[model samples]
Target: MVLQLHVWGPAFALPSIDAQCLSAIAYCSIALPKDAWELIASSDPSVSPTGELPALQNGSTWVSRFRNIVDYLRQYSDGAWDLDRQLDESDRADNTAFASFVESRGQSLIDLSLYVTSHNYYNNTSPAYGNLLQWPNQWILPPKLHGAAKARTDHLGLSSLDLQAIEEHRQRDHSAAVAAGKIPKNLIQRPRETVSGLLGRGSSKNQFRMEALTADFFEPLEAMLGQKAYLLTLKEEDVPSSLDCIALGSLSLALVPELAFPWLRDAMRAKAPLLSAYTERLRRRCFGDSPVEVAHAYSPQSAPASPLPWRAPGRISIAAVGSTLLAELADSTPFLSEIRRNNRLKQAAADSDLTSVEKGAVSMFADSSKKDMYVSIAAAVGGVAALVGYMFHVGLISVASQEQEFEEEEEEGIPDFGNLSAGDILGL
Candidate 1:
């Protein structure tokens, strides 16, 4: 019997890179049974409880959330989808951090696209459908007002909508990106494009936000490429045994296309074939005739002349209690030892001195100085260590808290798994 897989979503309308990556995985020969996959585009809430695109159902199991979907596919695929197959804990952590950054910020790109589409960019001269409006708002606005706004909104089209959406998405995106250690905080306010007079000059602020957001990923990209020749590679034999394929597949879809953006493309040209091939394939698949224009349209400012290499840089901030401890240990070990040695010399000087006044003064000075030094060092070290411990405790608590969140999210995302049955897809 043929394996049956159902992907329910308005995937075309959503146009999310992450969602597209999920589609790619679903369509990959190694991951899905031949010609057995189907995509359902209905908006019925019952079809996907989360009201999100890209929920997957196969046989007796239902999976939602991109990470869980990747995990579930890896189990049966023999780990073909594993991204961290060869990575150690630190490397894996780095990759996870990078992925989280991409996932969180990538939404901005999607939102920009949606905003444009809703504004009626394509057939605006004489719209087939009324002017598309904002998404969450469009879902509720009355039909009459939407029609009246059509001309003005359509004139603004994709570019204007995208510009605004990028600006709006940037605030939340930057906060999340910073929290993930993706970008420096300074870039958060940089300016780029100007809004037309009617839109007001303040619109230029939005452009700056996009530039700032894109800057964060540059270092991570350089780091990944600098470490290995292939952007990410998995042995053909291990395709089914790891989730590396899924992660690579996702990253390839997400970052590769952005290369066409002049700033990003120029930066990636050092590894031309890898970036070119990845972008070309996606352009052909998604944008077809207008690949070059689409690529350039999304381009940021020209790439930097010498981008920073990806090894961790800058002073370690004690953002979390755990990091504080690590920072303290890293910063104080040598200095603390030096202080101890210096104290020993001072004590010897006190013992050998002939003048009682001098000896007493030295003793008093040494006593006060040593006490101060010890207290200062101890406080610094102890504070950091305690912070580090507290950070870890908090992280664990957060993870536990998320367990229920994930379940609740899942419950709202996919239909009940209990309703599914074995042999509904592949018998195995």
Candidate 2:
């Protein structure tokens, strides 16, 4: 049976929007043959057993996340699919170290460039998600992702890059200035601070910070890749390793895509031209020239006798939508938020050793399933009540008017009992 790799849909000319999914796709592109596996742009995480993307399906079993998928594939083929198998002990150790570094630093940089910065997010990354997802999901997922990115980069202490926050601060200052009967300078300067002017607003400080962030991440990788075509390998013709795939995953998002800010990409090209070149070569080698078409080419009808490996955008089941809507609604309620927090604490206590991403998957399904059920039931009941109330309000469901009821009573009069005695009937 052909293994199926379900990942986030393609965007910005890349195989996947997410770094993890891109890494998984790159790994599969290198390790597996064309006929052995097929790519699916399933985008939705609810289809995954683990509530994560880059889920690998082999017949009835599914493996989630890029690292887990790699492990499973290695074990599946008894090391035949292991890209790191050829490395020495020392090289493997280096691989592990660099992978962690890339995940943390690289991910932070991506978050800053793509999500934390309001300009780039609103203009570029947000639209990218809109292109990838369906109606309700398009509305929901982008902000959720932006929130996640904000949470990840909160410790970076580079709030100056967050233009939205800066604007809010400016608004507060203006309000205070007006209240104190003082005219703020920005009030007069507002017309001059257009998109072009934003770059020059605090150019020195913001540019320095961005450059520092870029250098902190790229300098090490550039040093590692020096004079070699791939990281951890000396030969130009050697196959790219798992480390290469992982690095490419993050670097492609940073370097390949044309963002509104483009600081990271600019810095990468300027400072680390060698690594940039290496990333381009590897991306082409793994995904070929037309990566978008390669990623999204397979359709259900491509293999008539077998099951479809892909789910089209907006093609989710009604049940899935109902559950998602209920979850979103539940998340908005204070009581449910508290309940969710309590569940998270309890789950953390129970599974203290698991990594955050893996813990998220487990807790999402195991701890929150009952909560989701309860929320769904409550939402259904509330919806029914609302519908009935609306009908009553609109006169679709009405009781007789008091005057009409009185008139009907008078017309009917007191009911005469046929079985009553003759004297009683006559008196009545």
Candidate 3:
């Protein structure tokens, strides 16, 4: 029986990616019994209990959440999903940790994408403070900032003071978004406008940062996948499964365009086909094709056929697949800390109380923001202490030990030789 997969969401947002990924998996000819795929534009409650997009309906069951859907589809395929390559307990934990990491970082990507689309804010321009002007019809401000003071700033103009006020307003707005479950709580918040403006400026430094981070993410996966056709599994028989494609597709999106990573720039240029496919799909699903045309204006390359197909056979049992499959695809890096720091500085500069000079200084030395100053300083001190201790243990800081010995010599305290037993005094 052809599976009746009802996808509920618009074609141009985060949910769209979910839709596309699922579509690709289905197209790969996975055994989803119901073959018909239905995409509903509106967020129907009957379709989704949470009233969110990308919900799936099969038979009597309605499944929401992207990961849940991925899981559901896998069950219909039985053990073909290969969650974590059938790892033992320890490897499974590692996989879970990695998944959590990916999910958090993925949320940031989603937030940035949503911010870019919703406000027409690009990484190169300032984001529109529309929420401050008028609350989104479906979203309500949190109780903390629902009063008259917030209302005043909501309508504030784009003057210098108003710009500053908008930044401050967004800080609270972000918090509200988190509380309302619009965003993940642990994810860091950066001023969408400022970040977009920086990207717009296209500074060499900013470009370098983008390239470095992108390389850090993708290079490893490329190496892992190697010439083998797949990352985790080697067999062609394993090729068409959703688990295989989703993992690769997600990784390809997260890390690509070696221009973002200078060392791999040449390699990425050579393998442009792999990267372009994901972005083009993203463009098609998010911005209208027009924006994609703008994005690829100078590039002469064409998008490749997606490796995974988008049709399935019967109803997929989502819950049985488990989180292990998703976990193995996550990226683990300390870059998140740096990203968070940059975001915090951006938020600090947007505070109403900060003067223009303060904002400038904070932007220049992003690590020195009031919000992170003490914490950063403490972390630095703790890191130094740890390094010194490591060096001491390794006999590298002999000078310090000598200085300590000298300090002990300068003290008036005498050795308590009388307390030492003969056996202790000996080398026994």
Candidate 4:
């Protein structure tokens, strides 16, 4: 059976919106032959065994995340698919270091550009996700992604990029003031500020900060690449290593995508032209220069064939949708919401290497056994049923009883006159 690599659907003229997904795509396209594997834009994380995307399905087993996928591919079929096997020990160490660097710093840069900035997120990133997802999913996935981005870049102290962050801080201060029985500032309301207007105020400062961030990521890669065709090998004939795939994935997102705030792209072109060119050159070589349009809404039918292996998402599993809905509902409930928040805080505080994307998926029943999880679900369902029942009993909600329905059907069959009494009713 052919291996299936499931990922988020294409958006912003890229194979995948996510950096990790793009990394996985590049690796697979290089490692596996054209007929050996197919790409499916599932756009659903629940399809993965690990509840994430860029999942590689080989027979019954599934592998998730770029690093894990790389490891799996390297070992598959007795090392037939290993891209880095040709590397010497020193080059291999460099590969490991560079890959990690790209994943961390590159991810931060992407998040800051696409998601951390309120203007870019609202006008570009969020809409890109919306185009990539179905109805309910489009609503849920963007905020979740945005939150993950915020968490990842929070340590960088670039709150000015997100005007909403300023608003949130204001709200918190107001709440504190209210609790302390103190008057708040600016009781008189002014006109609501546009994000563009606010952004105009700090455009230069934000530009400098964004450039600094992007340079930190791109400069080292440029120096490493130098004049070589790829990252690792110096000869013109050397095949691009796994590190090249990772770097290409990261840089493509940074350089591609015409965002509302095009600071990242501008920075790359100005500060690191060679790296930007390398990203574009590598992407074109792998996926062709033709613009890959977003596929139609997911269907059971296969996606349209192209130079690149873009496939429509498989039929969404009902179970996966249900799981997503349940998770969202749990987050909305007060007690469960608190627990979920605490779990996220704990995960954030823990010294784990999991990325923000990986860390945010806090299980609703993280501490509970399967039985307890089932019981909780059942209780929630039962409570909803009981609440509806109580509403009907108190006349807040009304429904015709079966007997009343039957009586109405009989009456409709034979008309009853107000002037006629019991005899007329009997005749009817």
Cα lDDT for residue 406, model 4? Answer: 84
- lDDT over C-alpha atoms for residue 333 of model 4: 83
Which candidate should be chosen as best, given TM-score against the real structure? 2
Residue by residue across 344-419, what tens digits does model 1's lDDT show?
5565454342488777777677678767787888999999999889988779768878998999998898766686
At residue 63, give the lDDT of candidate 3: 60
Q: Write the per-residue lDDT of candidate 2 for residues 1-428, one digit (tens) a residue.
A: 88988888877778778999889988998888768888888788767766668789898898886777888999999999899988999999999899989988999999988898787899988988877776578888899999999999888776666777778888788888888979855565363233335556777776677778899999999999999888998898777788998999999999888788787798899989999999998888776665463235334343223212343344678888887788788879866766766665654444344777777777666567667767877998999999989988987545547667888899789776877997897896
In order, candidate lDDTs are 0.42, 0.79, 0.41, 0.78
Model 2 residue 116 distance off true place after TM-score fit, in angstroms: 1.8
lDDT (tens digit, per residue) of candidate 3 on 1-428: 23333332222222223323433333323433223343332222223443333556676776655456666656755645434445557645644554454444433332222222223222211111221112221222212122322333333221221234457778898888989999998887774554446445655665465455445444544454464543344563443323344443343333332121122233344444454344344333322343221112112133123221122122223431222223222212244445555765575465324689888877777755434656766898999999989988888778778899989987747667888898888967
lDDT of 1 at 175: 91
> 306-377 in candidate 4: lDDT tens per residue?
445555565667777788899899989866776666665554334245566555443323544344655877
* Model 3 vs truth, CA RMSD: 24.3
TM-score for candidate 4: 0.73
Q: Rank the candidates by TM-score, best first.
A: 2, 4, 1, 3
Error of 4 at 122 (Å): 0.7
**Superior candidate under TM-score, 2 versus 3:** 2
